[model samples]
Target: MGPLNGFTVIELGGIGPAPMGGMILADMGAEVIRIERANGTDPKQMRDVSARGKKSVVLNLKQPEGVETLLRMIENADVLIDPYRPGVCEKLGLGPEVCLQRNPRLVFARMTGWGQEGPLAHAAGHDINYISLTGALFATGRRGEKPVPPLNLVGDMGGGGMLLVNGVLAALLETASSGKGQAIDVAMVDGAAQLMWMFHGFQAIGGWDASQRGANLLDGAAHFYDTYECADGQFISVGSIEPQFYALLKQLAELPEEEFGNQNDPALWPELTDKLAAVFKRKTQAQWCEIMEGTDVCFAPVLSFMDAPSHPANVARNTYIEVDGVTQPAPAPRFSRTPSTVSHGPHSLGQDTEATLAAMGFAESEIKQLLESGTLGR
Candidate 1:
């Protein structure tokens, strides 16, 4: 039992960030019910690392009876999360206005690439497009090269999903005090821009450039913070930015004294990077890990997805687990009092349709009719 043990959340299924947000809440002991469309489309296709710890219920919102069924669940739910193009929810009659009316204490969370009322709110977009609009994508990768996709982490997970989770939790707290709920419009573009807040401060102080990609301190312009490829073609990331750590890095790498003469000089970054690269290439990633894993040099081998779980630190901490024969990272931010656990794996679409309906006070006869009319998927 985690902090959110008693909370019930209704997740209107979409993709990406929305599911990820639901997973976070579900991991924290919230009872997350995924409201899937009663269509022929398979739900398992979208089931990846993010769809764990949830129950699935399908309903045909296009049908009047289906809409009634959803309203009934909303009445009992503490939160309802949806990732839809601005007007889609309103059209489906599951919008915040209707749902909140049914349950004034419902925390209605709307996730989108571009927010609710913007001109591009209805425009089709994904993580890349959203980050691109906010100048976030342009800030990654090397100078004079197209921006590399950062695996959709910043926009999709960090921005969209994480922000929605925070907002929903905050709204829940507010509801506990005020006895009312509100809507949260979490936009990926907005959240990505917020993620660059520190850089924004640097720009205001004239220490940052908006146009120079990969030329900033944390973006790889500084020799102390960057990735290097080894002779084995494996990579390692290093971040010895502080003076003490940088000194340790130099000593560990056995660099000559001349290289230390201008450690902070921007003009020397390229030369230093080349020298460090050559030295790192002399050893395999594992060899370097043995020497520097827990040192002040701030070094770690860049393990692949499959290799990450086996690392000593991760394995010792139980950072990843195998569930249903699937290896995935464990839920984060440990709670000592009431520890969290994954209730179950990603569920089949509409697997709990009748169960959810019955819990929401739907009679068996009505459930049979809805199921027979294709208003609820089996």
Candidate 2:
């Protein structure tokens, strides 16, 4: 059994963050019923990667019967997450108001780019647009360069999906005592700003410059805390910040004593970075790994997606596993007991429609009627 073994979550079918939020719940052992549409549209097409570890049921919210079916599922669910734009769920009659009426103790999680209410609440936006508004995009990439999009990590999953997970979990905790559920308006923009809390503190303490990108201590401007390419063309990341770690890194790399002076001086970075780059390039990445892998220098070879699974450290820790012949990351944050594992690979859309609907008390005749009416779509 998973840590969330007894918990049930009804995931209103959508894309990106909502599904990922459900993935987190499912990872912890919650029964996440992905409420897919019955039109035979496969949810796996959205993303075969993070879309793993959940079950799906088809129900067309456009039809009254389908909406009713979703509400009935909510009646037994402890949490429900939806990423539709504002007013979409309300129009479908499966909004927080209706859901709370059916199950007041349900955690109604609503995720969106802007939020449930705001000037841009209904505006269609993606990860780039969402993080752009939160000062996050402006702070990314090299200085004076266009803000390079960090592929959807900053906004979609990190901010939007992970924020929904935290919100739902917090609301669940509150429900244990209050016996009431609440709407979780998790806005991607807001979550992005929340994620910048550390950077905000650094600026407040004068440790960071808001105008510069890639210039901060943690942002790759420092020679001692950055990625270096080796002779083999592969890369290794080094983050030897402290004096001891820096000394160790220098010793491991066989650097001259004359190269050391004023570690925190911003003026010395460009030259030091050049020198370090030249030194690192003298040896192959493998050679550097042999010298630095298990040290306090916080070094690691920059493994590609295909290489990560077979890395010694990852393999030793069981961080990656082969499932159905697919190499993927294992469930993280391991437990002393009640360890989690991916139950299976991605299933066909509505593959569990009959089983899920039956478990929710739908009869065979009702399922047939719904399917025949073009409501269930499947």
Candidate 3:
């Protein structure tokens, strides 16, 4: 059993951040029951890594009986993950007010891109749009180049999903002492902005340049903190920011002291970067790894998704696991006493509907009626 063994979460099924948050809770030993729509489309269910370690139940929320059933479930659920926009849940009669009224200890977490009550709260936006608003997107990419979307990792997963998980866990802990729960309005924009706090601080202290995208120390402007192309066309990243680490990198790469000395001078960065690029291109990623992998040079080969799982460090720590023939990342942030584990892979839609309803104390007759009435699905 893990840290959240005794907790129960009711995840209102949708895609993106909410499912990701639910997966994390399930991994941590919570009984996360996903209430999916009766006619939902999950064409890639088996490969949807975010759906792992959770149970799924189909319910036709358009029906009053289904809404009543969800309310009943919420009564016993420690947390309810609402992925819809602010008004969607209220329209379905499953809003925070109604759910909290039924279960005063329920932590109703609302996950959205714009938050519960803002001018853009009801706007249709995706990860890219949300991150763009927070300056996170603009802060990425190379100099004089268009900002590249770093996939959906920054907003959807990092800002939205991880933020929701953090809030839920903190609320759960507070509930233990207060014996009450509260609603958390988790917005991707807000969370993404929060992630930029360090950069904002750096800019305030004149250590960072906010006007230029790639002119900051950590934003690929410095010679010692960027990725270089190797001879094999592969890439390696180096973050030798500290003085000692920069010295080690210089020594390992055989960079001449006269040319590479003033590590912090911005004017010398472009020239030094060109020199480093030439040096790195002299060897393959593997060859460079041999010399600098375990050293204080703060270096690593930029591996592709196909190659990452096989890395020695990842292999040693079991950072990835295969579930239902799908290779994906393993549960993280290991605990000494209550380590998390993935109990199973993604469940098919409504796979656990009858069983879940029965466990919720629904009579067989009532369940059969709901199924026949189209309020429940197989």
Candidate 4:
């Protein structure tokens, strides 16, 4: 029901980012068909939180028939996402060159940590390593603290998966005019570097203190743009950068507005942060929420995963949905005319094998032959 409705996508199932990219496509109402290994995937992946709204098909790529089957599916697919190392798919005879040769209008997307060709192209790494090389990991933590990993969100999902999806969508839009598709080489490191573009400008302007991590306008160095611990050990975030907002914060906290001089004075940040911390610690998070939750003090209590869905604002917007008894975030960037919907949870390995192949125009005899040849796992 979304903008990408009727678009056919074939996902070469891999761990992490590729699955996430397929999920994003599926959430946007694309017909995503994931290719699983004949041996099947791990139970953890079978129930992956990001695997909703897709179908699964299994194939033994080691067999020639299996590779042929995939190529046939590529002929009908608009987008083919290959999440692997540079030559892995080429070695399997399923690379972009081969696939695009079969389908000139197919958008081929490759998501990798390094890239198609580089010194570290074939090196094994994860989200942390990818972001580490991009300067993003170095600037994520406190001034004096060890850099904290921003989960796998930055490199895996945000940089890798989201970037791949964006590339695929752009390629699709272009294909509408050109009637020809192209390959997208998406690297997690490249995406991570792209994400750090804003910080590069901040550094060039001499306003950012690149020497230290936390010493920046938006990096928790300023008192008005940081999180504080309350009396009950709970926390709340504040972003009162504007003069009126900062004044309101002081007024609500019962602190003298005159004590805070020159709001942008970097030299006075340490002292101002100390004072604000003390004031915030004197009250429970709930007590502070009562006074500032809806005000321009730019306040919000730090909500845990369990409590976030029930928060008044989140509840009002239905930010989360229950799928198979599990509560997870809803499809985002909502569409007004063609809204997206999750019809089911992740499919078990090869759960849709026969059905998907049949829908792809395989005859029952062909499906049975492939199954008997061990190329297709039913």
lDDT of each: 0.87, 0.85, 0.92, 0.90
Candidate 3 structure quality by residue, lDDT tens digits, 267-309: 8898888889999999999999999999999999999998999
TM-scores of all candidate predictions against the true structure:
0.97, 0.96, 0.98, 0.97
* Predicted candidate 1 versus true structure: per-residue lDDT over 238-274, tens digit per residue: 9998888988888888888776657787778887888
Per-residue lDDT for 25-120 in model 2, tens only? 787888888887666557565446555778877777877888887888799899988879999888888888889999999999999999999899
Task: TM-score for candidate 1, please give it.
Answer: 0.97
Regions more than 4 Å wrong, model 3: 43-46
Which ten contiguous residues of candidate 1 have the minimum total lDDT?
Answer: 40-49
Q: Could you tell me which 10 consecutive residues in candidate 4 have the lowest summed lDDT? A: 40-49
Q: Per-prediction RMSD in angstroms?
A: 1.3, 1.6, 1.0, 1.3
All candidates in order of TM-score, best leading: 3, 4, 1, 2
Model 4 Cα shift for residue 354 (angstroms): 0.3
Q: What is the alpha-carbon RMSD of candidate 1 to the true structure? A: 1.3
Model 2 misplaced regions, further than 4 Å: 44-47
